[model samples]
Target chain A: MDTDSPAGRARGPYAKSAERRRQIVDEAYRMFSTRGYQASSLREIAGAAGISLSNLQHHFASKEELLLAVLERRDETPAAETAAADTAENADENAAVPFDAAMVARAAANERIPGLIALYSVLSAEGVTDGHPGREFFLRRYDSLRAGYTAEFEEVRRQGRLRSGVDPAMAAASVVALWEGIQLQWLYAPDRIHAADALRAYLDLVIVSADDEGADA
Target chain B: MDTDSPAGRARGPYAKSAERRRQIVDEAYRMFSTRGYQASSLREIAGAAGISLSNLQHHFASKEELLLAVLERRDETPAAETAAADTAENADENAAVPFDAAMVARAAANERIPGLIALYSVLSAEGVTDGHPGREFFLRRYDSLRAGYTAEFEEVRRQGRLRSGVDPAMAAASVVALWEGIQLQWLYAPDRIHAADALRAYLDLVIVSADDEGADA
Candidate 1:
């Protein structure tokens, strides 16, 4: 085999170690998504990854560390996509889509990644309690998300896209709240709840198109 | 003191046992609210209640069973209040308030009981995982809430209270989702997130008054 080939280069200890870590994270993600954080044990994850408990502990000192790794991997996948999209030639054009509309679009996209949704729904809820390893992650996540949303809503309001009587700050909070609530419901009853549809409904109520604004006036 | 006087009679073993059980549940509720379900241990709860581990176990066989008792107590508190109001002389008049509006009122009420909200937010989110002890409770709770909301929305629509272009079923689901989502956010940042305000805003968008409906038509 050619030494330059990806498979031929896998013989090194460093690469093997990295590959093993990736396998552990993948197994943790799967187990966390289905069994949740507290219920899924380190032994089960190590077993699923075809590694011994000692090896897993060497990679991740504790289950909390492994959980953080799994969550980080989940976040990176989307962050990477967004980063790639940001560099695309039509990036500026893509920015024309309003934040609320983009949110609805993302909710639709989330349907295909139910495992991530399951993991998020479980951990974020679990994170609300004191001393949960994921608490700070969620607090920062929610704070940043709400701040980003508030700024976007302000911009939309400035463009006269928001309904005349709507308050941008409240609207921002509502959107975030709506997304979280709808997704939680969706997790409980996926067949019955429509996350994207509910999101779009809410957006339509608060955000008006230029044509609709003209008609309203 | 007379033997038949309220405070004069010596307490029976049954009353003492009931009081002890109540103490355990109360302590469990407090710990569960702040520390969350998974982070809280039976030993700590037992200690907080000033009972030994064996005695605590005698009253409640498992942590899951204790959790159920705590949840049941929480539910009963609200149910008791609502029941009192239901039998009030003006109960018919109170029924005139739309379901969404009542939910906003409840959100405001929930602010005074942040501990319950914390407990609920943690468990409901955690319950999304498979085989969680609270899963059946949350599943039934959400189902009943959604159904109630839908029925109430249907009535409101019949009375011309729901805004035109709003579907009752979606509106019902949205209201429930909004409550859950906003409350979770409130748990994270109590000072910043206005649960009632967000809920009322969403409700106003979906459920308009007679005058607003007339203007729309």
Candidate 2:
């Protein structure tokens, strides 16, 4: 995301362009979340971004083009961040998997970016149908994230961290399901459901330890 | 659902009316799932239903009213079935909570009605924002379902079926999350993830008994 060189940073126009793009993405995300992808218009997006229609079009030729920009910024990069976190977790030779705490922390972070989260939730359901523009992106997301989670479980299993008889594929899939379920509930009733705590509890049950045999169910 | 008495069953006009209503519901659900609640129009729904626009309107006063009818038929009645299933489970004194397997079966059955499931997934995400007409109904559905699940868990716990140390509310919330999450995944990639099996495994982990100590993770 920070593609600015020292020279690029110093140039006023480059910085301005980058700033304008960010504003458009942010405003567009909020609008897309509220009005949805099909119903929302470019003029509305332009107005929301405080830029003229021509100016907005100058940056991105069409609404679909703008949507790709918003989606790329919102989902693809954060997925990389999640992958990095998973890798880091795997790298720790002595680190106990604090899956519970990690889930809690992630939920807390989500609370700060309701717009992006809303965009994700709304579009997630929207994209599931046949031939929707966002379907491919969402499917790719599930493919990669599920792969990452499965890899985490396999490695953890090797380290004797994952409990016995747990299928990595199933665990990975369940994790995705828990995540989506908890997120949807949180969006619908944030005050009623704690996404992180709910995830943490599931993690605890899944990631059993040697001593957990004596632990309460 | 089967309200047909001998007289009702024999009457062609009544049967035709019922069939027409069902066709409208099916078409509306498919359209809503694909195009979304906000963007999809009454004309389009009527066209898809193979009925006159006015006739469709007669059956369903508006698109929102049609959506409510779909929600009621697809979700509400099935939810009642699930509750009855739960009550039956509670009645079995020797029954181990196969909450996960039951979850899977329910999901597989959902696959038989992709239109209804897709309608749910699509509309659920759409309804999270302010001023969405379906928001109140969805929120109430969650509140009630969560309460029902919690009550079931509490009763099961009293009977010593739920694992010790588990909170019923959290457990209920997790079940809801898993169901939502798994369904979305199945919609996205039916080939990759077996939503039911994924849910069953998570259930096994959470509802563990003393015997499960030696069982697989």
TM-score for each of the candidates: 0.85, 0.81
| TM value for model 1 | 0.85
The per-residue C-alpha lDDT of model 2 at residue B41 equals: 88
Residue A90's lDDT in candidate 2: 32
- lDDT string, candidate 2, B15-109, tens digits: 87788988898788777877788888889989987778999988888888988877776433545243312322333333463444555566666
**Residues B45-128, candidate 1, lDDT per residue (tens digit)?**
999999899999999999999989987785456442332111212223467764555666667777777767777877887777
lDDT of each: 0.74, 0.71
Docking class of 1: medium
* Model 1: how far residue B198 lies from native, Å: 0.5
The iRMS of model 1 comes to: 1.7
Instruction: Give lDDT tens digits, candidate 2, residues A12-115.
Output: 67787988988888788788878788878889989988889999988889887888787877334543233212322333433464544554566666766666
